[model samples]
Target: MPTADPASLFWFLFLFATFVWPAWERQRIHLRRLWKIHELQRRRGTRVITLIHRQEALSLLGIPLARYINIEDSEQVLRAVRLTPGDMPIDLVLHTPGGLVLAAEQIAAALRRHPARVTVFVPHYAMSGGTLLALAADEIVMDEHAVLGPVDPQLGQFPAASILRAVSRKPVAEVDDETLILADVAEKAVRQVQDFVRELVADKLPPDRAETIVRDLTEGQWTHDYPITFEKLRSYGLPVRAGLPREVYELMELFPQPAGRRPSVQYVPVHDVEPRRRRHP
Candidate 1:
């Protein structure tokens, strides 16, 4: 048998440490996340699915890439929903900045048809399409400070409402053909979302109340990036509650945002605290 050169052995080990180790570490974190998800499932007695889209630095230059609800996400979620028994409840941990409306609508429609209860957990914020998905849930579980956002459609880079507003301010002939076309599409988009939202909440709320909810969310009452706080959602009579499972929070930790050169936010991880008593004056 020929003996390997010492230099070749040393370089092999060096390359493995530099490249292979990171891949292995990532796999370990993935497995840990799965374990946490299973633990949450056992505690809640529901099938747990996570639609978490975190920004990650995937390139050598550490350029952060954003993730969102897309066709692939919708496909996977629909598959998971189908695999679950009809009688089994679903707990969806949703953390996204929203994505394609078409994909989101597909997911929401499937969840609406599910026979068992569907709960959406928002550990942070779920905007646009994310909010659309939450609307399908029987109950929305949010962190006290978590937020939802308007579902008004976006036409390219502009809000559909904004497009219509701009066109309405100008005379029909003054508007270019392209602008008129966009305005037409915007009108239809807004109406389509309003009708869909009404359908989603019809079983849960009275007709008048459901219409109100639909208008507030899909009629561009607020900016597309507006944060609908827990309190505001409650004021609207949405079936939203505060409090998230500890396991869910732990799971979020495993899907961390990509680290920059220096940490943007940092704090000591103090688990529990007792308030300090004031001395009598």
Candidate 2:
């Protein structure tokens, strides 16, 4: 028999080992580790940290359903964190679209209760509740483009419903009356949000200053691209500082103490925790 074509044999083995075997192995490893983490969470009481993103109607593939942090889920995580030894820090990686006000308040309260320091990492934007959660953190780390949104409470109601109610109740062509009614509605919405901001931030800032900040953030012409940048946050009399990505990276390597030092939460990419697989030719 012609000596087995050495090159063909090598290619066959290489394909089997590099392509087929590795793919199967990777899947197996992924599933195994996923199960292991679940079990570990169930068994050992460790520092429980969660990632919250925007709410989507549906989740694609294995992507996590993003929404404002769920109050219930936050409670569960807080319970777990509370179980962790007091000496261990609870590091929460938060990226959120800022969800329900009540939920955010609950999350903030839980963060406050934990004996260990709560460190929040904002790799990207964390608006509304995300910003509220960051306030509870001993330190907050932000990337260059990362932002926090105005803590404006957006009330959701059908504009059509409101207009119909007004039309049914009031005489037509009373333009001045209609304008005053609309202004009143707008003021109520602004006041509601201002009250909440007062509760969260007033203790940290002077009462009058806090009220003024809330008014500007909520009453100003809203913009989708608006950002509560570090400069703006400081100007509002909140304790905030600029964080460079490079500085955070170095700090992560060093793992310095957070207290007294400026809050230095690091933005860790998901790939840093779970790297992508390479394909074999």
Best by lDDT: 1
Question: Where is the poorest 10-residue window by lDDT in model 1?
Answer: 267-276
lDDT of each prediction vs. the true structure?
Answer: 0.92, 0.61
Q: For candidate 2, give the lDDT.
A: 0.61
lDDT of 1 by residue, 36-130 (tens): 99999999899999999999888446789999899999999999999999999999999999999999999999999999999999999999999
Clashing pairs in 1: none
Among the numbered candidates, top TM-score falls to 1
Q: Please provide, for model 2 over 21-50, each residue's C-alpha lDDT reduced to its tens digit, 9 standing for 90 to 100.
A: 756755875566455444434443335365
Candidate 2, superposed: residue stretches over 4 Å from native: 1-48, 54-66, 84-89, 157-192, 244-281
Over all chains combined, what TM-score does candidate 2 have? Answer: 0.55
Worst 10 residues of 2 by lDDT: 251-260
